[model samples]
Target: MGRIIAVANQKGGVGKTTTAINLSACLAEKKKKVLTIDIDPQGNTTSGLGVDKNMVENTVYELFLEECALKDCIQPSVMENLEIIPSNINLSGAEIELISMENKEYLLKNNLDAIKNDYDFIIIDCPPSLNLLTVNAMVASDTVLVPIQCEYYALEGLSQLMHTIDLIKERLNPKLEIEGVVFTMYDARTNLSSQVVENVKENLNKKIYKTIIPRNVRLAEAPSYGMPVNMYDSRSAGAEAYRFLAEEVIEREDEDAWL
Candidate 1:
C-alpha cells in the first residue's frame, strides 16, 4: 500500500504547498511513483506541478460531487512518475456542499483507498484552514507533515493544529500519525531563524527533520515557471534541502518498516 501523507499547516505562508510540490517531485526523481492531491482550492500545488488547473476537465471537486471517477481526476504532471488530482477554485464551495452529505469526511478516503496500492507515496496539499476539505485530507492520509516557517511567529497556531489532528485521530482516522515537522524558509544569516528553530524544538515534541529549507530566490521563482526547484535549478539550496528531506522521508519509512 502507498504511504499517504498530507502536507498541512493551518498557518498560511508556511511553505505547505511548496513542500508538497518539491517533495513529491524529488521523490519521483528518486524513481518512486508518487501522486499529489491538491485539496486546497487555491490550486497552487496543481499549478506548481505544471498542471493548468483552470484547464483541467476533471478535478477533486468533481470527484467529491460524484461527477467523475477518481481515476478520471488523476492527471499526468510535467514530471515523470508524479501524478496529480488537480483542484480549482470550484473546490472552495465543497465545504458547504459536504455539510449536507453523509460520511462527508470519508469521501476522500473512500476514493483514495481504491487507488492506494498504485503508488509508493501520496502527498496531499491541504488548505490553510481547518475546514471540511482539510478534514477530508486528514481522514484520507496516514500521516500529516507540517511545514513551519523559521520566523518570529513560527509556533503560533501549532497547538490548535495539533489538537485538530488529535481529534481526527481520535474520531476519524485512528491510524493517522504525524510524519514529522520540517523547518522552511530558514535564513542562515539571521539569528532570529535559529532562535525560532530552537524554540520549536524546545516546545514541540514532534520529530524534526534535520534538513532546513533556506529562503532562496530561485525557490520562489520556480513556481511561476511551473517547475519544481529541482527541475528549475538543481544546484539551488532550496532544491538540495527538499532532496535531503525526501531522503529523510524514505529513510524514516525504511526504519519504520524494519521496526
Candidate 2:
C-alpha cells in the first residue's frame, strides 16, 4: 500500500504547498508513482502542478460532499509518474458541509482505501488551518510532515499543531505519527535563521529533516509558470534540496521497514 503523508502547517506562507508540490514531483522523478491531493481551497498545489483550477471538473470537493469515488477525482499531471486530485474554491465550504455527517473524520480515510495501493506515495496539501479539512487529512494519513518557516514566532504555532496531532492520534487515528519537521524559507546569512533552526532542533520532538529549504527565487517563480522547481530549473538550489529530501525520506522508510 502507498504511504499517505499530509504536508500541513496552520501558519500560512511557511512553504507547505511548495513542499507538497516539489516533493511529490521529485519522488516521481525518482520513478515512484505519486499522487498529490490538494485539499486546500486555495488550490495552490493544484495550480503549482500546472492544472488550472477553473478548468478542473472532478475535484476533491465532490469526493467529500458528493461522495464521489477517488478514481473519479484523480487527474494526471504533466509529470510522468505523478497524478493529482485538484481542488478549488468549491472546497472552501467543505468544513460546514462535513460537520453534520456521521463519522465525518473518517470520510477521507475510508474513501482513499480503495485507491491507496495504486501509487507509491499519496501526498496531501492541507488547508492552512486546524479545521474539519485538516482533521480529515490527518485521519486519512499515516503521518504528517510539518514545514516550519525560519522566521519570528515560528515555534509559537507549533505547540498548537502538535496538540491537534496528539488529539487525532488518541481519538481518530492511533497509527498517525509525525513524519518529520522541515525548515523552510531559510536564509543562512541571517542570524535569526540560525537561531530558529537551533531552537527548533532543540525543542521539537519530531525528526528534523537535514534538508533545509533555502529562500530561492526560483522556487517562488516556478508556481507562476505552473511547474515544480526541478522541472523549472533542475540545477537550482531549491530543486537540489527537495531531491535530497526525497532521498532522506526513502532512506528513513527503508530503515523503518528493517526495524
Candidate 3:
C-alpha cells in the first residue's frame, strides 16, 4: 500500500502548502508515483502543481460527496509521475455537509483504501484549520508532516495541534503518527531563526528534519507560475532544501520497512 501522508498545520502562512507541493514534486522527481491531494478549499496545491482548479470537472469535493469516483477525480499534473486530486471553493461547505453523514471521518479513508496500492506516496494538502476536513485527513493518513515557520511565535498553537493529533489517534486512527516537523522560512542572518529552531528542538518531542527551508524568492514565486520550486528554479535554495527533505523522507520509510 502507498504511504499516505497529510501535510498539515493549523497555522496559516507557515509554508504548509509549499511543503506539500514541493515535497510531492521532489518525490515524483525521484521516480516515485505520487498522488498529491488538495483538500484545502483554497486549492493552492492544485494550481501550484499546474492544474487549473476552476477548470476541473471532478474535484475532491465531488469525491467527498460521492458525486464521482476517486479515480475520476485524479488528474495528471504537468510533472511526470505526479498526479493530483484537485480541490476548489466547493469544498468549503464539506464540513457542514459532512456533519450529518454517517461515519464521515472514515469517508476519505475508505475511498483511498481502494486506490492506495497504485501509488508509492499519497500526499494530502490539508486546509489550514483543525476542522472536519482536517479530521478526515488525519483519519485517512498514516502520518502527518507539520511545517513550522521559524518565526517569533513558532511554538504558539503547536500544543493544540499536538493535542488534536493525540485525540484523533486515540479515538479514530490508531495508526496515525507524526511524520516529523520541518522548519521553514529560515534566514541564515537572523538570530531569531536560530533561536526559534533551538526553542522548538527543546520544547517539541517529535522528530525534526534536518532540512530547513530557506526564505527564497523562488519558493514564494513558484505558486504564481503554477510550478513547484524544483521546476521553477531547480538551482534555487528552496528546491535544494525540499529535495533533501524528500531524501530524508524516503530514508525514513526504508528504515521503517526494515523494522
Candidate 4:
C-alpha cells in the first residue's frame, strides 16, 4: 500500500497548499508515482498543478458523494508522474452535507483504500479548519505533515492542531502519526525566523524537516502561472527547498523501514 499523507494546517496562509503541490511534484520528479488529492474548497492545489477548475468533470466532491469511481476522478497533471483528484468551490458544501451521513468520517478513508496501491504516495491538501473534512483526511491518512510558517503566533496555532490530532488518534484513527513538521517562508536575514524555528523545535516532539522553505517571489508567482516552482524556476530558492524536502521525506521512509 502507498503512504497516504495529509498536508494540513488549521491556520491558513501557512503554505499548506504550496507544500502539497510542490512536494508532490518533487516526489514525482524523483520517479515515484504520486497522487495529490485536493480536499480544500479553495482549490489552490487543483490550480497549482495546472488543472483547470472550469473544465473538471469529476472531483473529490463526487468521490465523497460516491457519484463516481476513484479512477474516474483521477486526472493526470502537467507532470508526467503526478496525478490529481481536483477540487473546486463545490467542495465547500461537503461539510454540511456529510453531517447527515452514517460513518461520515470514514467516507474518505473507505474511498481511498480502493486505490491506495496505485501510487507510491497520496498527498491530501486539507482545508484550513477542524471540521468534518479535516477529520476525514486525518482518518484516511497514515500520517499528517504540518507546514508551519516562520512568523509570530506560529506555535500558538500549532497547539490547537496538535490537540485535534490527539483526539483523532484517540477515537478515530489510532494508526495516525505525525509525518513531520516543515518550516516555510523562512527569512534567514531576520532573527524572528530563526527564533520561530527554535521555538517550534523546543515545543514539538515531531521531527523538523531539515529543508526550510525560504520566502521566495518565485513560489508566489508559480501558482498564478499554473505550475510548480520547480517547473517554473528550478533554480529558485523555493524549488531547491522543496527538492530537498522530498529527499528528506524519502530518506525518512528508508529509516522507518529499517527501524
Pull out the clashing pairs in model 3.
Answer: none
What lDDT score belongs to each candidate, Candidate 1 first? 0.94, 0.92, 0.94, 0.92
Question: Residue 227 in model 3: shift from native, Å?
Answer: 0.5
Candidate 2, residue 233: lDDT: 96
Q: Candidate 4's C-alpha lDDT?
A: 0.92
lDDT of 2: 0.92
RMSD of each: 1.9, 2.0, 2.0, 1.9
Clashing pairs in 4: none
Clashing pairs in 1: none
Tens digit per residue, CA lDDT, model 4, 45-138: 9999999976899999999988999889999898989999999999999888777889999998998888899889999999999888899999
lDDT of 2 by residue, 39-107 (tens): 999999999999999898889999898667778889988799999999999999888888888998888
TM-score of each: 0.97, 0.96, 0.97, 0.97
RMSD of 1: 1.9
Model 4 residue runs over 4 Å out of place are 254-259
Candidate 3, which segments miss by more than 4 Å at Cα?
254-259
lDDT for each residue of candidate 1 in 1-259, tens digit (9 for 90 to 100): 7999999999999999999999999999999999999999999999999999999999999999999999899999989999999999999998888788999999999999999999999999999999999999999999999999999999999999999999999999999999999999999999999999999999998888888999999999999999999999999999999999999999885644221
At residue 136, give the lDDT of candidate 2: 93
